[model samples]
Target chain A: MTVTPHELLAQMASTFRHEIGPAVDEPFAKTQAFMAAVILSKLAGQLQAAEADAQAAGDERRAVVAALRARLGSACPARLGDALTDLGHDGSDAAWSRLVGSLYAERDGLGADEFDALLGVVRSALRARLDRALAYAS
Target chain B: MTDAAAPVETRIAGYLAGKLGADDLRLRDVQRIAVGWSHETWLLDASWTADGVQHERGFCVRRDPGNALLREMSDLGVQFDVLRALEATPVPTPRAYFFEPGVDVLGAPFLVMEKVAGVCPSPWGSDGRRFYEAAAGRGVLPGSFTDALVAIHNVDWRAAGLDFLGVPALGTDFAAREIAKWRSLIDATGIQPDPVLTDLICWLEANVPSTDRLVLVHGAYRTGNLLIDDDRVSAVLDWETEVIGDPMYDVAYVLSELNRERTELLSNIVERDAFRRRYEQGTGIEIDDDACRYYQLLYAMRSAAFWMSATGLFASGRNTDLRLARTAWSIPVVLDNAARALGY
Candidate 1:
């Protein structure tokens, strides 16, 4: 644990890309080594921001779910409302994912204007989460 | 154990002997070709003496990799059937010889076909772009590219016994079926839920397009999938995704920006106007822009499914290939593209 996983991966990736990859003769094998290096490097980058991204995403999900619950008032489906109410300040990723799926499933049943409004907020947050997830993605 | 020890060249020779019924059957130039993502392709030269006549031919064998990128969707037997059925048609394709169902010979199911002489330029690579550019200036390759696609669209699949690829019943059935097909694949990955991907899927389902005409759709019709010889499309390779669906599906692929590298030409070869004109003239089906837009979005979703399955396979230890691991990075990238297409 002394050498952090990201640091170790970064060193290994550098070795692979600079040392092992150049010496590999076979075209396919060389490409494989290079790709392995790329994956390791990207994983290292992801590790740097992963925790912060997950926290930001969790906060956004909680905020959006809370707002949706308040917007629906008594009209909210008990199944979804109960799930939303159960989310703590720091909601786990799984609960948020399930709530998102439920929202998508129930979107068609809502009035067109309501559906559009809910979708707008959810999609904006979804975009932020995706952007963070793909920050280092090729 | 004994069979595993025996060289694949030896078994291939024996298999060819049985198929050709010739004496002194031999295989030469037995080399593996690393190109396709789904199949283990091998290039070999086969020779045999029949009635004191010497005959030699080049062949390519595509063997299933057991857990290929599109394992659930690809069928080597179906590809062989398609090639065999296309032999009488005008469409350019490799001449398929035999399909081996048993794994004893080569460790997996394989299809043997005549190795069409040609080079397939990679669509995104600089060298490939240069090759296509040089060929485009010559003008023959671009025309051949369109002509080959036209031939596929013009093929009477029902008459050619390709109806086994289920025919969609009514309007929007093709789009709906395609969406469902990729959705099932995404579901199979068991990856964490992606709201963007889920939204894209729902939107595709709700906006399914109506299609009155059905033709053979080469699902991944693009620059890299075509074989070029003498500045002409010698063969349309990669038959794994062929289906009986809308022709515009193929057209939309040519139009997609994913297949080009900083090039304005469709597929980085044919001029956009010329391709549309020639395709319409040959197939007699007008290019529908609205349907094409929808199919392009479907293509984006399909691409996301592919990357998700790829990454999931690597993450779950179903495959150890570095290429599969690399695909994990593309999942979010492709999903973002789909979100943009959905106007997110």
Candidate 2:
């Protein structure tokens, strides 16, 4: 009874191909329809995995902060240490939802350079956590 | 838009008359073949009567489109320059005749070039086995695809007169440059968080390997991009992404794809040790394993990032190339491979 975004996209794509696509005179309209289907399929796949992946990523980030605290001992910079401590405590789904929301809100405000720096920080934290996990498992 | 009948053809004919240094030149049977994401390619028939003889020719015009991904390289003159220089080399490229960089002629930068007749392998085509078979069956190509790649790498960059092109600063520090460029591309597109890709990029940066060897790298060299006839490469097309950087990047690109296919033909085509030895023999450069692995991982990451950016572009309506939208689905697969290469 309820149609999600993924289902709606698929329905629209099917309608376009069956109803509007045949009447279009554009040379590449058929190719465009096929491509739209491909994209819809990918979106469907992403919708299936996005929530689980986000949760896993948040847990992974928290683990990295704990490992960083252990590795830094007492020499870690005060600002970075404080940020890590804060991130470590706020590993709940609510925090992740808020972070995602804030990112969307600030998406246009952040320039390319600033966004890259932010991504770099997040990536570094994730990498450090992955390394710690590998070492522990090994 | 000009009338589809005689007026537009006559205008184009007039433009060519000036360039051809002849009178009574005319264009006939002009039709739009396909509009590429970057350029609009059209097939046209041209004829002119000079010195009591009639001459007819079939040629192609590649003109820039609005909001292309490679805006900086949109100048047909630059493409012409590269293709002209490559004429004397073993590299397979289309022969360029005239390059018009100004909008005064056709409202956009355009080039007239000799069209090579061949079937281009589609990366998204479902018939993967057929595609690989056709490529492998090109008898003129070397038994080892690496040999052809070695020939490309061994090209004299200085002799090619590309020094003026200004190689990237990351040429000397390839790993750093590779990471930075892709990161910049991702940032520019402003896509949503792709956790798998983000994780892979982090893994690649941390696992950077040390090496000093540098060679000409075809940024997107792979089976799909090459034109094969009679089991040999007739020509290597798509120089838009060419750069002088880590040679391992190209090698890793081929190897990573071949690894995915896992076919006996590909396996037998180039044994790891023999391929390296042959490449060194041909190019006089030794292959570095650690650096190759690092670049191989980098190539995968670059592919993932590029696909993500393309997806974002289409989704946001900045560009609406169906090919880019289709390619976005492969980003996860590429990221997974990059992660595997990084031993994550």
Candidate 3:
């Protein structure tokens, strides 16, 4: 659900392209196998992910960000406000990670209770992501 | 480049011949055994004649493939020295021998040591679980396991000249240095920094514990890392992560549920209470639960770093092993653990 599945599929496709296709005795068959691998990978990337998963994940991310911002109040630091903006705009995991870093960096100004409250938001989001991750994990 | 080619056994034999001062030397049972994730370990018997006396000795050759998970930390030469230092101690280990740094003799930098006789059963596997269960039922192995850890902690690292391991200053320096070590590994890898991991690292850094005692910590002290024979710990293996730090780091490892698979027995062998009693009695050092807790959290960060490094190695094409690629899944799994540990 996170980065694992896509990376796994890419690695598998690479193994097929680099090792499996190269092992073919006939040059024509090897070239064809390599071509098929590349085409199949491109197809799998767009087709593998369900629309339902993205929508559910987006809802969770939005809820986590909203709760965090609400806890920060209107007088929250500009850095945190901008981080949430980048997170919503880009919708990238890196954005979430940066928000986390920003929170820790601003912890001293936020004080103990506020910092803990904000951390709780990230923790809940992490657990939700972990629930999806367990599907790929052994 | 003769050593780099197909038959590595011949090269190893020729190298051993010169070292042993033997006119005719041969290697038997030269089979590679996957001892740990980092090093290429081969168990073999070297037979030869020196001074008109024939002899055969079991030797384990550990070679650094250069792309190992802990390649940045594990040193074969240092390991050889550590083994040599431990020869006078009660701790059971493979006797240190020749350590060759150059690739002229072997395909890679390899160290040959006296291979202690024992079988290391994987505590993570079902069959291995059954083996430990039976051994625990017999009741001696559990005590032996505890005693082995006790002996390791009891080692006078200063007297033994283990200070080359870079001792951290008293107090928070030990914990801080450890966090830096694992953090550096995470930084070196091109893996994405998961926020959960970032939070965990932040927590670990904010709460570095002070140590009262500094002893030789095995870093990974558990059933799988220990060699068992005759229901006793014949030797402790996997010295790659060994360090001169608080012994609680190793104790935290044994206390971890990661070593036990669906079992009540700690490390699938020793009972926690008995282990504590024997360990405390043997070492005259009380097990600090607080320190253990902090170290456990540090372990979570280290685990993430390890998996990230493994996946990074595969991703960078440094190593093409599918197993390394498979570890990409462990990043989330370990973060799941770290979050749970943090009560998230």
Candidate 4:
């Protein structure tokens, strides 16, 4: 852990691509080695931004969930309301995912206007998250 | 893993000799082809002497790699059976020969079939796109692509002994079944929940479309799955995901933008109007636009399931193929597409 993780990844990638890849004889095996090197290089490039992005995304998700819950109020399905409450103020990625699933799964029985309103609110937040993700991924 | 000292060639020759009833069977020039993510395909030349006559043939042996991309869903035996059933039809397929389901034979199940001679251009890579671009101008390949898919959709799967693949009964069973199938695979991944995927699944379940007609559906019908020879579709390969479902499932695949790159042409091979006209005329079934749209979303979900399973396999150390590791990036990319498809 002492060495910069990105530097270590860059070195490993270089070894795989420049040294180990050339020595592999089998075509498929050779492709695997080179592809592993490419993935490592990608990891090296993305390492610096990963933690900060996760934190930011978490904050945005909690805000969105709170806004949606206030709008739902007593209309919220008991199961979904409980799931969201369990995530507390700072929701993990997996919990957010589960909450989304719960929300959609409960959408059918809701009145058309209520469902549309809920969807609009959720979609806006989803789009925001997606934009940030795409930017980071690029 | 196979015994390296004896060689796969020796093992193959031995297997063929027992089945062929010839002691002098010879396997020549065995080479593993780097295609098919789920199965290992080996191309080899086989020769034998029987009744004082020499017989030679080229064969492809597809073996289960134990931890393939879609290991839980695909079966080598089922593929063999499907090929056997299709042999009597006009559907372009390689003739499957021997099938072994037990892992005792070569440490895994495998199926030996006639190696259809053709080139399967990858739909993703630049060179593959160029191959289709050139072939599109030639005119013959595009027509052949349309005709081959039509042949598959026109087949009477029930009469052809393909009922072994369960038939989805009445109304929206087909759509529901497909969603359930993929959901099972998602559950198998044992990864953290994906909210977008869960929402997509709910949406799919809520809006299941009614199936007007059922036929033999090639689950992943596209430019990459077809084998081309002499500028014509020589064979339709990759029967692993074939199912008895709505014809629109296959149509949606051809219609999806995933198969095309920098080209307005469908599958980067045929013009859209041309493909639609030919398919409608050949199959005599009007293109149901709504049904196709629904199946397109289903395809997106299926694609997401594939990436999740692939990434999970790598993370769990079930398999170390770099392709699986690389799929980790594809998971979000596909989920993003699915989210857009759901209008989120």
Candidate 5:
């Protein structure tokens, strides 16, 4: 009885092609209808996995920031770490946006050495989380 | 969509006729042909009487679509000018005849160029061997593709009198700049989140490699983009992505695509090691492994992002080409490869 993501995507793709594509008058518009269908298909695959992946990534990101904060003591910017920590707990869309934005902001503010150190930690954490998520899903 | 007369083609022929100082200029056989990703191309049969002499010629005219991925660099006149200037150089490019940047001529900017006859490796073709064989046999692909690339690198940009092109100076941080540029483009397009692509981009930025040498980077150098003939590269087509930066960008691109197909070829048209060795031998330029790996991953990621953007454009109803829409499906695969290359 349950409609899978794949099924939903297939339905959407067919609907877009048959119902929407033919109705489009402009060449560019017709192209968009087709692309939308393709993107929807891609998004379907991501949707099946992204939520769990993001949750795991959120946990790891928070852990990395906590460790960096501990090492740097008071000198470490509390704002970015705090934002990541909040995102880890609430797991809200706004929190995720803020977390990503803070990381980017910190990257811009900090020197390459400091930025890379932080980024390396973030990348390592994300990769570990992604691996875990993939393992769990499989 | 009208069949009467492709207005754009007629206008282009009219402009070319004026430039050639001829009367009774007619653009016949203006058949719309599909080529390249961004432009509407037409092959026209042009004829006129000059000094009581009748001359007919076949040429191509390309006009900009309303929306293009390379919109910032959509000045067809600039591309035409580059071709015009490069005609004197060893780099084989079509001879541009007329470049009209104004909208008055064709409802958009267009250019007319002498259409060189050759088989461009079609990406959609099934027979890879035939394509490579034809490319190698026609001398369209050099003994090593890398050698041809180095030849492009060896071109004295100064002697070409192309200072006006404002080729970016190569820097140690060239890879970083490139990463930032593509990232910005992805961000600007505001396409939906692609987690795999995002992860790949993050990985690439984190692992920026050192540059060993500086040379002209053909932003897009792959098998499908080149026109080949009789075992030699007749002409290198599509210079829209040409820039002055790390030479490894082009090297990495060619190596990644040609490596798989090289095994099947009789003469080893483009083996990765042989290509690199030949390039270094010919140009006295050393190849850097770390830089090559970085740029190879970068090329994959950049290509994926570009395709994503194209898909976005098509999805948003801004550009409608069935091929463009279909090609979007391949971006994720490329992104997956990029992620693997980056050890993600």
Candidate 6:
């Protein structure tokens, strides 16, 4: 049996959007059908982009970690260092969350200028990641 | 006595008959309305006779689906109490009739109240926007909208027994408490914490503003949440997130760009300066732009929490509504906006 998930999803998306949703009479039901189409289409995009997104994410993660490391130098708080490892070893959404928390927690110690400098690096990487997520969502 | 085997209309008719002590009670126009994500609302006309007198009334029923968005936060029973408390107040709300806390009746907990006469056009739709724009030119609804909000903010919470909504301490406790509430919701939804969200939350905490006065704050106040009749706000609806907190919380909601579309008019109805002048005059509270800015970010967090809860409901298979499923995309969208607002 041939397994084509993307084709199946695209078919369902089109069916829901063009056929099922328009055919429905009830307001909520029609909305639900249209929303199903939207979700399915997004899912298709996300599944297709998974590999490329992962590669881009990995490259960005490594760059962000290196930048943060270079900025931190001797000033890297233990909590922040732990957060930095999640970028390399763990590589999860939660890694950046933890890094952000640590950055704010250690802000007083790092002082205003250094904290702002490090945050700029994190923001660039975050923007790129958000852009990728947005590409698949719409 | 009614059973689940009966259709919803029959069961509700039977239940209302018993409640009203009239055996011949009947319901008409028993249609579900798209009111809010947290509840299944039905607007119906119920009629019966007692003591040789005829009676007719429109009823609004809000039913909790158990797995609706922010299920942990919004309680229909509390809403019933809140409505009853507002009956004599300046706030134009539906009179509370009954609160069914058990599942034996409607298959879920629900509240039935007077269905106030109004048109609650959705702010997101073009038709609705045109309705508001026309109403704005006519100029009655704009003033009516501001007056409705003023009444809500100026309501005496303590005297009106609304203190049950909890009171935050004098300082930045309101902001901290709000942050804690939304953060807990985000954690409960089990959405993987995003860096932008974390950054926004951290910024919100560090810049927590002190509130001088605690007034009843309608957490999500805007045009769509209002019900209009004859160019006046006949009823202030969507009473899900009312709180005994800073008035600026609601003010910030009014000032939020999230509520309006491409229109320069705030909420697609009222002029911003006109609203501010009217609101400040009515509430006796100075308009704090800085506090409004702060609460705007807090609202961003709250908005993210809503999308997370909605997507969680769909993902867990607890809800089959595709609208909930579609909101999964909104999480990233809201976070992106929040990140931009935080200068990310």
The best candidate in terms of DockQ: 6
- By summed lDDT, the worst window of 10 consecutive residues in model 1 chain B runs over B1-10
TM-score of chain B of each: 0.97, 0.80, 0.97, 0.96, 0.85, 0.98
Rank by TM-score, highest first: 6, 1, 4, 3, 5, 2
Q: Residue B194 error for model 6, in Å?
A: 1.5
Q: Which stretches of candidate 5 lie over 4 Å from their true place?
A: A1-76, A89-138, B1-6, B133-147, B167-170, B192-214, B257-269, B321-332
Candidate 1 stretches with Cα past 4 Å from truth are: A79-101
lDDT values, one for every candidate: 0.85, 0.62, 0.84, 0.84, 0.66, 0.88
Model 5 C-alpha lDDT per residue in residues B38-134, reported as the tens digit of each score: 7778877888888899988888788887677665544687778778778887776778888777676777777788777666655434576566765
**Candidate with the larger TM-score of 1 and 6:** 6
DockQ for the candidates, in order: 0.61, 0.15, 0.36, 0.55, 0.15, 0.75
TM-score for chain A of every candidate model?
A: 0.83, 0.49, 0.63, 0.74, 0.54, 0.90
> Which prediction has the highest TM-score against the true structure?
6
The TM-scores of all predictions, comma-separated, are 0.94, 0.74, 0.88, 0.93, 0.76, 0.96
Candidate 6 runs further than 4 Å off: A1-8, A22-29
Which of the CAPRI classes, incorrect, acceptable, medium or high, describes model 1?
A: medium
Clashing pairs in 4: A97-B195
State the lDDT at A108 in candidate 4. 69
Clashes of 4: 1
Tens-digit per-residue lDDT, B114-200, candidate 3:
888888999888899999999999999999999989999999999999999999888889999999999999999966688788888
**Candidate 1 C-alpha error for residue B79, in Å:** 0.6
TM-score of 5: 0.76
User: How would you encode candidate 6's per-residue C-alpha lDDT over B267-334 as one tens digit per residue?
Assistant: 99999999999988998899999999899989989988898898888888888888888887887888
Shift of residue A77 alpha carbon in model 4, Å: 3.2
lDDT of 4: 0.84
What tens digits encode model 6's per-residue C-alpha lDDT throughout A4-94?
A: 7876897899999999999999988898899888888888888878889989989989999998898788778999998998777766878
